[model samples]
Target chain A: MGTQAIRFVGYIFGAALLGLLALPVTSLVGAISVQKFLAGVYHPLFWPAISLSLRTTILSIGFVVLLGTPLAWWMAHQTSRIGRLTTVVVHLPIIMPPAVVGVALLQAFGRKGWFGTLLSAQGLNVSFTVAAVVIAQMTVAAPFYVQASIQAFKKISPDVWVVARSLGASPIEVFLRVGVPMAIPGLISGVLLAWARALGEFGATLVFAGNRVGHTQTLPLAIFYALESDIELALVFSLILVLVGLVVILVISQW
Target chain B: MVDTSLIVQVQVSLGDFMLDVDLSISMKGRLAVIGPNGSGKTTLLKTIVGSVYPDKGHILVGDRVLSDTKLRIEVPVEDRQVGYVPQDYTLFPHMNVINNVAFGLSTGGRRGSRACKKEIALRMLGRFGCQQIAYRPVQQLSGGERQQVALAQALVTEPRLLLLDEPLVALDMTSRRVVRLLLQNYLSQLDIPTVFTTHDVRDVVSLADSVIVLSRGKVVQMGTLEELQKQPCNDFLVEFLGQQ
Candidate 1:
C-alpha cells in the first residue's frame, strides 16, 4: 500500500478504537438530564452505596499499601525461582475473572469454606457482610498496588541501598528513609491505580458480599441494581466513578 | 611493622565465575583493585561491605568480625562501620546535600539531635569545599559536586574502613584530575584503611600504595604497582600497566 493510504487506514483504526472506548462514557453522560441526574443522586440507595464504597475502598487500599509495600520490596530484591513464582501468584488476580475471584474468596472465607468452620467456631462469620465487600475489593485490587510497587522499588539502584546500609542505616531504616522516599512517586501512582480498581470492583463484590441496600451494596453494586429499575441512577453512579478515575489519572500525570 | 587493619578471605560463586580472594592491608593503607569488566572487582568491594555474602569466608576490619561463615557470626551492614561509594555515588535524591550526609548520624547509634547532625554534616561538607551546596538537592548537582558530597557523606560517619568503587570513572578528564588530587589529599589525612577499585592507572599511581589485579574472579597479583610492573601476570595486566 502507498504511505498515504497506510496512514489513512491507521487513522481510521485508531479513531474507531477511541470511539468504541468513549461510547459508553459519553452515552451515559449524554443520556442524563440534570433533573434525572439530581433525582438519582437523591435516591435512597445512592448515598448508602457511595458511603459504603468510599469506606470499603479506603480500608482495602490502606491494607493493600500496608501489606503490599513490604511484600513488593522483598519481591524486588529476590533473584531466586521462588521470588519469580511469588510474583506470578501475586499477579494472578489481575488476569483472573472477578467472578472466579469471588468464588475463591468464598472457598477461603465463606461459612462453608476453608476457614469458615474455624472462624465460625470463634463466633465470627465473614460471608455476605460489609467486611466481605472490603475483602473482595482487596482481592481484586491488591495486585495492582503490588505490581506498581514492585516496579517502583526495583527502579532503585541496589547501590543506593548498599550505600545507605554502609552509612550505618539499618535495613529497615534504609527501606524507610531511602527506599520509600525514592519510590514515593511510583507508590503514589500505585495507590491511585489500586484505589480506582477497588472503587470500580463489581463482580467479586456482588457474588461475595451479596448486594444489600445500606449494608453490603457498594456504588458499583448499586449501579447494577439501579440498571434493573432506573437507568438514570446507573448513569449517575457511572459518572461519579468516571470523575473519580479522572482525578486519579490527573494526579498520576502530575507525578 | 605496619599494623594489619583489614583482612578479607572469601569464596563466592557468581554463575560461572568463582571469586576466591584472600588479602590483608595495614592501618591507613590504600589498596587499589584493578580488573577488566566482569572480573569481580566490584564484587570484592561488596563482600567487604557486607552487601554480598560469600559462600564461605570471613571479613575482619580492625578488631570487628564483620562476617565469619564457620563461626556463624555475620555483622549486619549497618554495624560494620564501613563507608562505601558505589560507581554512580548513589546519593539519596530525595534529600538535600546536608541531609544526605547527616543521614548516617541521624540513623546510626550516634546520640545527636537533628540540628547537631546537620552541623556536623555541614562541617564535613565545608571541609570538602561543598558547604555552599549543603541545601542544594542532590539531583541538581554536577558530577564533581556529587563526588564531593558522596565523599563527605561517607567520611562524616567516621567509619573504620572505606570502600570506593570506580570513584573517578564518572568524571570528565579535567574534573578527574582535579578530583584525583582532592581525593589523594583527603585520603592522606584519613587514619583508617581505604580500598578503591579503578581501571585508571593514574588513580592507582596517585591514591593507592598497593595494587591487586583481578581477572575473571581470581586475584592475578597483589603487590606495589612497581612490583607488579616488574613481573606482570597476564596480557591484560601487561596492557593495563602499559597505560602507566
Candidate 2:
C-alpha cells in the first residue's frame, strides 16, 4: 500500500478503538433523559447518598492533602533508607485491587482486628461506618496525590531550595512560600486525580464500609443498589457519575 | 573599613574527588575563584555558603563563626546571612521579579510589612534598571534580565557576604559587558566581602580584587591579578591568566 493509504488505515483503526471503548458509556448516556433523570434523582434515598459521597470524598481529599503533602515533602528531601523505601511502598495502592485494600483495612481496623480491639475498648468501632468509607477512599486515592506530589517536588532543582534557604528563609517558610508555590501546578493535578479516584471508589468501600443505606451508601454503592432495584434509577446514577467524571477530566486537561 | 574579613578552611570529599582549601580575605575584598571545569570552584563557594557542609575546618565571617567542625557548631543555611546566585540564576519561576527580589528581605533577614517589602524590591529593581519588568514572571525574563533580578534578590537582603557562581557567564558579549559594568558599579558600593567564580579572565580583571586559582579541588595560588600575571607560580596559572 502507499504511505497515504497506510496512514488512512491507521486513522481508521484508531477511530474504531475509540468508538469501541466509548460505546458502553455512550449507550448509558443515551439511556437516560435529563427530565427523566431529574425526576428520578430527587428520591429520598438519592440525596443522602449524594451528600454522603460528597462529604466523604471531600473529607478524604482533605486528609490526603494534610497527610500526603508533608509526607511527600519529607520523602522528597530525605536521602535516608526509610525515605527510599517509602517511595516504593507509596505506589502499592495504585497497583493493588481496591477489594484487597478493603480487606487489608478490615484486618487492621475491624472490630476484632489489631487496632480495632484497642479502639473498641474505648467504645469506638470503625468498621461498616462512614469513617471506614473515608478511610477506604483515602487508602486507594492518597497514593495518586502522593506520587504526583513527589514527582512535582523532585522536578524542582535542589539549587532553588538551597537558594531559598541561603536567602534566610526558615525551613518552614521555604517550604510554604517557595516549594509549595513552585509545585502548585503539579500538586493541583495530583489533587484532581486523587479526588476522581476517591469518587469512583467501590470495591473497597463495599467490603470495608458495607452497603448500608443512609449510613454508608456512597454514590457508587447507591448506583449498584439502584441497578438491582430499578434500571432507570441505575441509569440516572450512572449518567450523573459519567457527567462528574467528564467535568473532572475536562478541568484537569484544561488546567 | 567594614570589618568584612572572611576566613575559610574547609575540606570536603565529593564523590572520588576531595576538596581542601584555606583562604582569607580582608574587608571589601572581591575574590574571583578561577578554574577549569570540575576544579571545585563551585563546591568551595557552596561550602562557604553552607549548602555543602565541610567534613573538617571552619568558616568565619567577621567575628561570627559560620561553620566550626571542631566546635561541633554548624550554622543553618538560613541563619548564615549569605546571598547566593547559582550559575543558572535559580530564580523562582513562579514568582515575578518584584516578589523574587523581595523574598529574602520579607522572609527572615529583615521583617517589613508587605507594602514596605514591595517598595524595597522596586528600589532594588530600579537600581538594576529592571523596574519596568517587575511584574513579569522569571520564566518570561531574558537571560540578562534574570541575572539582574537574581543579583537584586541577593543584594536586597543586605547580606554580610555574597556568593555568586558565574553571575556573568550566561550572557552574550554585549549583555555581559553591560552587566559587568553594572555589577562593578554596584559591587564597588558595597563594603561587604564578595566571592564570585568565573572562567573568563576579563571578568577577574574587571570585577575581582584578588584571584584564587583552583585545580583538582585545591587552591593552586592566590594573589592580585597583576601579581599573579607578573609572577607565574605554575604553568596552569600562566596559561589561565595568559588567556586574557
Candidate 3:
C-alpha cells in the first residue's frame, strides 16, 4: 500500500476504537436528563449503596496501604529466591479471574471452611457480611498498591540510605524522612489506582458479599440490581463511577 | 611514630570478589585510595562507615569500636559517627540544601530546636561558600556546587571520621580544578582522620598525605606518592600514575 493510504487506514482504525470506548458512556449520559439524575440520587437505594461503597472502599484502601507498604519495601530490598517467589505470589490476584477469587474466599471463610469454623466458634461469621465486602475489595486491590510501591521503593539509590545512616539517622528515621518523601508521587498514584479498582469491584464482591441493600450492596451492586427495575438509576450510578475514574486519571497524570 | 587514630582490618566476600586489607592510619593527615574500577575502593570506605559489614576483622576509630565480627559486636551506622559522601553526592532530592545539611542534627536530637539546627547547617554551608544555595533544591545545583553542599552536609554532623567515594570524578575540567583547591584548603584544617577514594592523580598530589594502590581488591602498594613513583610495584600502578 502507498504511505498515504496506510496513514488513512490507521486513522480510521484509531477513530473506530475511540468511538467504541466513548459511545457507551456518552449514551448513558445522554439518555438521563438532569431531572431524572437528581431524582435517581434521592432513590432509597441511592444513599445506601453510595454510603456502603464509600465506607467499605475507604476501609479497604486504609488496610491495603498499611499492610502493603512494608511488604513492598521488604520485597524491593530482597534479592533471594524467596523474594522472587513473593513477587509472583503478590501478582497472582491481579491475573486470577475475579469470580474464582470470590469462590476461593468463600471456601476459606465460609462456615464449613477451616478458618470459618474457627471464627464461628468465637461467635464471628465473615461470610456474606459487610466485613466480607471490605475483605473482597481488599483482596482484589492490594496487589496494585503493593506492585506500585515496590517500583517506587526500588527507584531510590542505595547510596542515599547509606548516606542518611552515616549522618546519624536511624532506620525508622530514614524510612519516614527520606524513603516516604522520595516515593510520595508514585505512592499517591498507586493509591488512586487501587481506590478506583476497589470502587468498581463487582464479580468478587457479588459472589462473596451477596446483594443486600443498606449493607453489602455497594454502588456497583446497586447498579446491577437497579438494571432490573429502573434503568435510569443504573445509568446514574454508572455515570458517577465513570466521573470518579476520570478524576483519578487526571490526578495521576499530574504526578 | 604518630598515634594511630584509625585501625581497619577486614575481610569481606562480595559475590565472586573478596576484599582483604589491614591498616593502621594516623589522624595527622588524609589518606587516598586509588584503584581501577571494581577494585573495592568504595567497599573499604563503606566498611569503615558501618554500611557494609565485614565477614571477619575489627574496625576501630579513635577509642570506639565500630565493628568486630569475632566479638559479635557491630555498632549500627547511625551510632558510628562517620560521615560519608557517596560517588554522585546523593543528596536527598526531596529537601533543599539547608534541610539536607540539617538532617543529621535534627534527626539525632542533638540538643537543638529546628531553627537552631538550621542555623548550624547554614553556618556549615557558609564555610563551603554555599550559603547562597541553602534554600535552593539540591536538584538545581551545578556539579561543583553539589560537591560543596555534600561536604557541608557530611561535616555538619561533626563526625569523628569522614569517608568520601570518588570525590572529584564527576566534575568537568574547570570545576575539577576549583573543587580540588576548595577541598585541599578545607580538608587541611580538619583534625579528624579522612579517607577518600579517587581516580585523578591531582587529588593525591594536592590533597592526600599518603596513598594506597589497590588491584583486584588487594592493597598492592602503600606509601607516599613519591615512594610509589620511585618504585612502581605492578603494571596497574605504572599505568595509573602515568609512569609508562
Candidate 4:
C-alpha cells in the first residue's frame, strides 16, 4: 500500500476502536422511545435508587476530600518508605477489580470476620448495611481522588509554599489560600472522577452492602435488579449514567 | 536611624557537604551575599527564614531570637516576620497581582477586612509603579513585573528583615536594568535589615553596601567592596571578583 493509504488505514482502525466503545451507548439510547425513557425514569425503583446513590456518593466524596487531601499533600511532598508505600496502596484501587474489592470488604467487615466480630459483639454490623454501601463506594473511589490529588499537589512548585510560609502564612493558611487554589482544576477533576466512580459502583456494593431497595440499592444496583425483570428500567439507569458521565467529562476538559 | 543588626551562627550538613557560616552585619541598606554556585548562599538565607533548620547555633535579628538550637527554641517561618522574595519570583499564579501582594497583609489575621487589605496592597503596588496592572493575573505578567509584584508581596507585611534570592537572575538584560534600579531605590529607603544573594559583581557594586563572599559552603571574606579591593582574602576571592 501507498503511504497515504497506510495512514488512512491507521486512522480508520483507531476510529473503529472508538466507535465500538461508543456504539453500545448510542444504540441503547436510540432503541428507547423518549416517553418510555421518561416513564422509566419516574418509576418507583428509580427514585429510591437515585436517592440512595446520591446520598452514598456525596458522602463518599466528602470523606475522600476530607481524608485524601492531607494524605495527598503529605505523600506528594515527602519521600519516605511510608510515603511510597501509601502512594502504592492508594493507587491500587484504580486498577484492582471491583469484585475483588467487594470480596475483601466482605471478609474484613462481615459479622463473623475480623473487626466485624468485634463490632458485632458491641451490637453493630458493617456488612449488608447502608453504611456498607458507603464504605464499599469509598474503598473503590477514594483512591481515584487521592491519586489525582497527589498529582495536583505535586504539579505546584514547593517554592510557592516556601514563599507563602516566609510571608507569615500558617500551614493551614498556605494550604487553603495558596496550595488549594493553585491545584483547583486538577482537584476538581479528581472529585468528579471519584463521584462518578462511586455512583456507578456495582460489584463492591452488591457483595458488601447487598441490593435492597430503599436501603442499600443504588442506581447501579437498581439497574442490576431491573435486568432480571424489566429491561426498560435498566436502560433508563444506564442512560442517566451515560449522560452524567458525558457532562462530567465535558466540564473537566473545559477546566 | 535605629540600627538593625542580624547575627547568624549556623552549622548545617548538606549531603556530604558541611555548611558552616558565621556573620554579624548591622544592616542599613542592602548586604549582598555574592558567591559561586554550591557556596551555600541560598542555604544561609533559608536557614534565617526557617525553611532549613540549623543543626546548632542561633540566629538573632535585632533583639529577637529567630532560632536557638541549644535552647530548643526555633521560631517557625510564619512567626519570623521576615519578608522573602525567592528566585524566579514564585508569585501565586492563581491570584492577580493585587491579591498576591495582599496575601502577605491578609494572611494570619495581621490585617483587617479584604477591602482594607486591598487598599494597602494598591498603595504598595503604586509605590513600585505597577499599580496599573494590579488586577492582571500573575501568570500573564512579564518577568520584571512578576519580580516587582513579588517584592510588593514581601514588603506588604512590614517585616523586620528582607531576604531576596537572586532577584535579577531570571530577568532579561532590558528588564534587569529596570528591576535592579527599582530594587536599589527600595533597598536604600527601607530601614530594616536586608540580605540578598547574587552572582553578578555589578549587583553587589550598585545595590549593596557590604559584601560577604562564600566558597564551598563557607564564608571566605567579609568586608565592604572598597576594603575587598584593597586586600583580597585568597586567590579564589581575587579570581571570583576578577580583580587584583
Candidate 5:
C-alpha cells in the first residue's frame, strides 16, 4: 500500500511537472511554425550551434567511450563489494540534476575554484573559452556514458565473455569484437544520451563558460541567452533542441 | 586419436554449500556427473569453464596446466575453449540464428564472425530436424528447438571438450529420446571428450560411458552404468535408482 501510494504520488507529481513544463514544450514546438523552423535552421547562430554542438557532442562521446568503456567493463566484471561501491559512485552524477552539475562545475572550474587558480597561476585562460564548454559538457554528460556502458557490459552474460576469452580472444579483442557488439544496445543508448546531454548542456556552460555567442553558446545555453531578449527565439532554439533530442532518442531506442 | 584425458581437482564453498571435485576422463569418454538438485555439478563446470575459481587445486587439459591456485596460473576462459551448454540454453535473444552461430568464430572486423557455413548451425539444426528455424529468434523457438540450437551453438565452435548441464532434462520424453539419440550419434562420430551432468538415470545409462555419483558434494562412486546398477553402493545409490 505504501509502495502504491508512493507511486500514486509520483504519478501526480509527474503530471503536475509535465503540465508546468508543457508551456515551454509547446512554446518550443510552436516557435517552429514549420516555416520559421526551416528558415531558423538557416540562421547563423542556429547552424553554428548545431554544427558546434554536433562536433563537440561527437568529440565528448568519443572521449567518454574511450575512457568509460574500460571502466565500465572493469566495474561489471567485479563481484566484490568494492565494485558495487564504485558503481554507486560512478552513477552519482547521472542522478544529480543538471543545475547542481552546473553549480558544482562553477565552483570547481569557475575563476575562484581550485583548478581555476592553478590554471590562472600558469597564465592559462581556460575560463569563458571553448575548452570550458567541453569541460562543462563533459562534467554533466560523461556519467551517462559510464552508466550506459556499465549496464551494457553487465547485460552481457559473463559466460559469453569467459567463453570468448577461452576461445583465444585477448581481453582487448574480446572487448572490441565480442563485448561491444553484445552490448551494442546499451552502449549506443549511453553514447546517444551522453551526446544529447552534452549538446544541450546549459546550466554548467552558462555558469562556468558564460553565454558568449559563437564560443560557448550551445543550443541550450543559446536558448537561455535568447530568452532574455526574445522569448520566441528562445522557444525556436528550444524547439530544435527538442526535435534533435527526440530523433536521437528514437535512434537510440531502435538500437 | 586425440588424447582427451581429463583431470580436475577443485575445492570451494558457495552459500554454505561446500564442493570438492576430483576426477579423470579419457578420449572418446562420456562422463555423466549424476547428482540431486544443488549438488555443485554446475559449480564444477563453471570452474572448469573459468567463470568461477576454485580455492585450491588444478585442471590439466592435455599437456597444458590450466589452473593451480598455489602458483596463480589461472588461464582465462577465452583461451580455454571448453564449450558449455548451460542448462537453460541461454541463447542470445536479440541475435538471429546465424549471428548466434557466428559468435564462435573470428571474423576479422566483420559483424558475423563464424561465417563458415555458420549455417552448419543449420546442419546441426538439420540433425535436430530444425533447418526450418534458420531465421527465427531463439526466444520464439520451442523448448526442443532451443535445446537443439544450444547444442548446435556449443558444437559450432568445434570445442575439444563439451560440457552439458542437464541437456536432456528440459525436453519432453519424445524430444528427449530423439535428442539423446542424435547426441549419441554425433558424439560417436567425434573423439572429443564430453562430460554431462544430470539426475536422470536414463541420461546416465543412455549417454554416459562412465558415471560419477555426487552426493552432498563428494564423489561417492565412479564406474560404468552397469557397474552402478549391479552394485548399488548404499541407501543413497539405491534411493537414487528408485527415484530415477
Candidate 6:
C-alpha cells in the first residue's frame, strides 16, 4: 500500500475529528441562553477573577522574562555540566504532577519550611497572598520561557555577539539590541504560552495561594468555585479562557 | 613610541583536543593567520579580541598590554579598541549600513553623539564608496556590501589594530573584485596595522604586508608573499600557493 494515500486519509480523518470536537462548542455557543451568560458575565465574582488572573500572570511572566533571558543566555554560552544540570532542573515543574508542585511550594515557603518562617517574621506573608499565586505561576511557567529563550539564543550565531563586543557594544547592549531583537519571535511566543499556562494554573494556585475571592482567586479558581453550584459561571470562565487563548494565538501568529 | 609586537601564548582544552600556541605580530604591518578549520585559527582571533580568556597567556598589542598570564594583566574587550570583522562579514541584519558602521564608534570610550556616530559612519562609507547603500539593512546587501559595511564599521572606530577573520569569504566573484580593489587601496593608504585570516592566497597578493601560514596550529612559514612564492618550502605551501 502506498503510504501517500494513508497520509491523505490521516489528514482527512484528523480534520474531521477536529471538526467534531469543534461542533459541540459551536452548538453550545449558538444555543447559549443569553440571559444566563450575560448575567453571569456581569456577576461580581467573574470580573475580579479575570483582573486577578491578568495581574498575577503578567507579573509572573514579567519576572520569568527578567530572570529567564540571562539564564537562557548563560545556558547557551556556558560549557559546564552545572549549566546543563540547571537547565534540566529548571524544567522540573513542567513535568511534575500539579499537586506535587503545590506541595513543594508549600514546603519551601510555608512557615515551618526553609525561608517561609523568615519571610513571615519579616512582616510579609506569601502563602495565602497574591504574591503566592504569582510564585505558583512562575514555578510552573518559567521553564517555558527559559526553554524558548535558549532555543532563540541558539538560533543566533555566537560569533555575532563576539563581533558586537569587538565593535564596542557592551554586554548589556548586545543582549538588548542584538540578542533580544533576533530572538523576539521565539521569546514573545514563549511568553504568551507561559501566560496561558499560568492563567489556568489551578491545583498549585489552590494549595499555595489559598483561593480568597477578590484577592487571590484567579479565573481558574473561579471556575472551580462556579463548578460546585453554578455551571453557567463555569461555562463563562471556560469561554473567557478560550477567547484569550485564541487571542494569544493570533498575537503570536503576527510574530 | 611603543612596541606593536603582539606576543601571544595560550592554552585551552576541548575534551581531548588542546590548543597551545605562541604567536606574535607588529603594528603598521599585516599578519595572515592561515590554517585549516579546528586548527585554532579562530581561537587565536577570539582570544586576541577578548571574547575568550586564555587558560594561560600574554597578549600585547602596540602600546597596550592587553593580557599576560604571568602578570595577570587583563584589559576587557571594551577597552581594547580592536576592530574585528569576523567571517561572513557578520553584519547586523536589523541595522542599516550606517548604523552597522557606527557600532564600532562605541566602546568604553565616551559614546559619540548620534549625529557624530552617523557622521563618522557616513565618512567611512564614503571612503569605501558605499554611501549609496548607507540606509539599507545589511541583510538586504550583497556579500560585498555586507563586507564593506562590516569593514566600514570596524574602521570608523579608529581602532588601534584591525582583527579580521576571513574577510573575503562572503563575497561573489564580481563583488569580490570590486571590494578587493577598494580594500587593497584602503590598506595601502591607511597607516594602521592589521591581522587577518584566510584560506586564499589572494589575501596575500592583494593586502598582506607579511604572511603567517599555520598548518595544524603551528606557523609553517612567515615572510612577504613574493618571498614565499619564490621559495615554496613545503608541500602544503606549494599546493596552497598554486591555487586560484
Find the candidate with the highest lDDT and give its number: 1
DockQ of each: 0.87, 0.82, 0.82, 0.78, 0.36, 0.67
Regions of candidate 1 where Cα sits further than 4 Å from its true position: none
Selected candidate, larger TM-score, 4 vs 6: 6
Measured against the true structure, the TM-scores of the candidates, in listed sequence, are 0.97, 0.92, 0.93, 0.90, 0.82, 0.92
Q: Per-residue lDDT tens digits of candidate 2, residues A201-253? A: 99999999999999999999998998898879888887888888888888888
Candidate 1 C-alpha lDDT tens digits along B118-170: 99999999999999999999989989999999999999999999999999999
Against the true structure, what is model 2's DockQ?
A: 0.82
Cα-based lDDT for every prediction? 0.92, 0.90, 0.91, 0.89, 0.77, 0.82
Cα error of candidate 6 at position A156, Å: 1.7
CA lDDT of B117 in candidate 1? 87
Model 2 stretches astray by more than 4 angstroms: A1-17, B1-4, B230-243
Question: What TM value does model 3 have?
Answer: 0.93
Cα lDDT of model 5 by residue, B1-244, tens digit: 6555678888877878888989988877999998777778888888887888888899877767778988899987766767788877767666776556656665324345355556556676676567788888877887778877777777776777788888887888898888787778777776678888887787777788999888777788889987898898767678777756
Worst window of 10 by summed lDDT in candidate 3 chain A: A105-114
Interface RMSD of each: 0.7, 0.9, 0.7, 0.8, 3.1, 1.5
The TM-score ranking, best first, is: 1, 3, 2, 6, 4, 5
* Candidate 2, chain A: TM-score against the reference: 0.94
Q: How many clashes does each candidate structure show, in the order listed?
A: 0, 0, 0, 0, 11, 1
Between which residue pairs do clashes occur in model 4? none
Off by over 4 Å in 5: A1-24, A27-44, A95-125, A249-255, B1-4, B90-158, B230-240
Rank candidates, lDDT, best first: 1, 3, 2, 4, 6, 5
Tell me the TM-score for chain B of model 6: 0.90
Ranking by DockQ: 1, 2, 3, 4, 6, 5
CA shift of B213, model 5, Å: 2.4
